[model samples]
Target: MRIYKVGGAVRDRLLGKPVTDIDWVVVGATTEEMLAKGFRPVGADFPVFLHPNSGEEYALARTERKSGRGYGGFTFHASPEVTLEEDLIRRDLTINAMAEDDQQNLTDPYHGQRDLEARLLRHVSPAFAEDPLRVLRVARFAARYAALGFTVAPETLELMRQLSESGELEALTPERSWKEISRALMENQPQVFIEVLRACGALKVLMPEVDALFGVPQPPAHHPEIDTGVHTLSVLQQAALHKQPLTVRWACLLHDLGKGLTPEQEWPQHIAHEFKGLKLIKAVNERFKAPRDCQELAMLVGEYHTHGHRALELKPSTLLELLQSFDVYRRPQRFEEFIAACEMDARGREGLEQRSYPQADYLRGAATAARTIAVQPLLEKGFKGPELGEAIKRERLKALKAYKENA
Candidate 1:
């Protein structure tokens, strides 16, 4: 059994980036051979084993055939006849299709190394069409590597467009779509991801709510671009530029999702879009099976768009009351996430009169300060038992009053 490093570990190593996980390809090895060597068989559909000692995965060199639809419709072949070269040829992208032997010998029959050098993302073969997931993968790679100046190969993008047009994207599960989206949200430039998906026609299939933003008009007074899509993208750009966390970045992306549906009869008609967006986001969260924390964060973004800044100036009692509006203790990070998202949202518009809301800066600063102060048990104040609870309540009221008076 010959073992070689494959996938992200090798790609990261070649790029001089820190390697996180290592995958191995086992050449000339059978499941029986692996089991004989004390490797535990774990994969249900593919011949994957874990080393008994190291616990690292060692997948037998295999090839795949399209069996049904979407990403999951694949049949893998791992017989003795399947060569490592043939296995690599079936991979999604040229850069990821290369592997290295245990002795550091390169096995790049697909010219992945040259493509890597050229900072290009190219498909290994026409067989790429067999997997619809490759389009999302390419969009993700665009988000991750575009900052390094990599460009997707033209033919590969054409193939992605064709896949979208063929409706293969419809077969993708929302869970799978969100997985790629979450990764993109975690990237340095999530806007690139949205743009890439839009270019490939995958965005409309995956998230039609966002697609509706494309041509929806915004007020000229607030948004110079006059399109909800551009405004949403601008917010995403700010989130990326600030390097916000995943949930905050997602909040920025979805913050204006309801604006497209808001009436355009009056300028800035999206004033109440945040309220509408909350229900829509909840439905989306449920459909995508988002975690409770993410769902709560999205809802908070929708509910408090106008009041988040005002919340900072509330008295301690009022602040505590506001905090109780949601499970702040269980999800302490959501407030800051909301602030970051709202900041991005407020800053996204292109043409606001010079001084529409000077309170924004004050509100942001106050929110940050409030968070820092709230971490301490000011209510306890050297009291114990029932007195402790009373002191805590009194201090909360005092803090809220202080905040409001100061603002």
Candidate 2:
């Protein structure tokens, strides 16, 4: 059996990028042979094993055939007869199809190295169109390597567009699609993922809520970008520029979903879009089965982002209510995430990227001021039960009022 370092490890190494994980492909190896050699079998559908010592994944060189539809509708064949080149060709992209042997020699059966040199994202073979998930995977790769000037090959994009039109995207499970989306959000240029998906019409099938924002108009005075979709992409870019976490980036993307639903008569002024957006956010969360933290933060940013923008104008009680709504005392980190998301929203407009968002500090200080309010003082005044809770609220509200005044 010959083992070779394959896929991302080889690709990233040649690109001068950090290699986080190294996947291995064992050619001419059987499950019995692997098990005899102390390799632990882990793959349920294919012959994937873990090294006895390193515990790293080592999958057998295998080929896949389109069995049905969607991403998971594939039949994999792994045997001593399957060639390494066959395994490589079944990969999603050319850059990911390359491999490195133990002797430090590179395998370029599909010209992956040449495409990498050309700064292009090309499919390994025509079989790429068989898997709908490749469309998302290619978009994600585009997002990850966008800073390196990589562009999708025109032919590859046409394949993605064809896949989009084939209705195969509808067969994707929410969990699988969300896996790609969430990973893409953390990439170097997450907005490029969205743009690439849109270019191939995958966004409309995967995220119709986000797609609807494309041609929707917004007030040019506040959003010089004018298009709600463009503004959302800007916000995602700002989130990445600031190195914000996944929760913040996701909130920024979904924060403006309501704007897309604004009645044409309402035009650029979405007076209560915040409330309207909560429904859209809920739909996305439920559809994607998003994590509780991501869903909760997206919902909060969607429903209260305007309140965040208007922090300086809100009354003391309103500020206290907002803090309590975030449950800052129990979950202070989430509050920071909320503020970061809102700040990205404020600075995402054209020519406003460098603009300061003092509302973040204002609200942060309000939370701090409220946190400093002592419940002991109310207890010392003989307050009990619900009365004590009410008194504590009053004191916190009074403190926030003072804090607002001082600011």
Best-fitting candidate, scored by TM-score: 2
Residue 5 in model 2: lDDT:
97
Residue-level lDDT of model 1, residues 234-300, one tens digit each, is: 8888778878887777777777777867775753577677777777787778777776767777787
Give the whole-model CA lDDT for all candidates, comma-separated. 0.78, 0.93
Clashing pairs in 1: 315-400, 315-401, 316-396, 316-399, 316-400, 317-396, 317-397, 379-392
The CA-based lDDT of model 1 is what? 0.78
Off by over 4 Å in 1: 309-324, 327-331, 349-402
lDDT of the structure predicted as candidate 2: 0.93
Model 1 residue 26 CA deviation (Å) reads: 1.4
Model 2 bad stretches (over 4 Å) = none
TM-score for each model: 0.84, 0.98
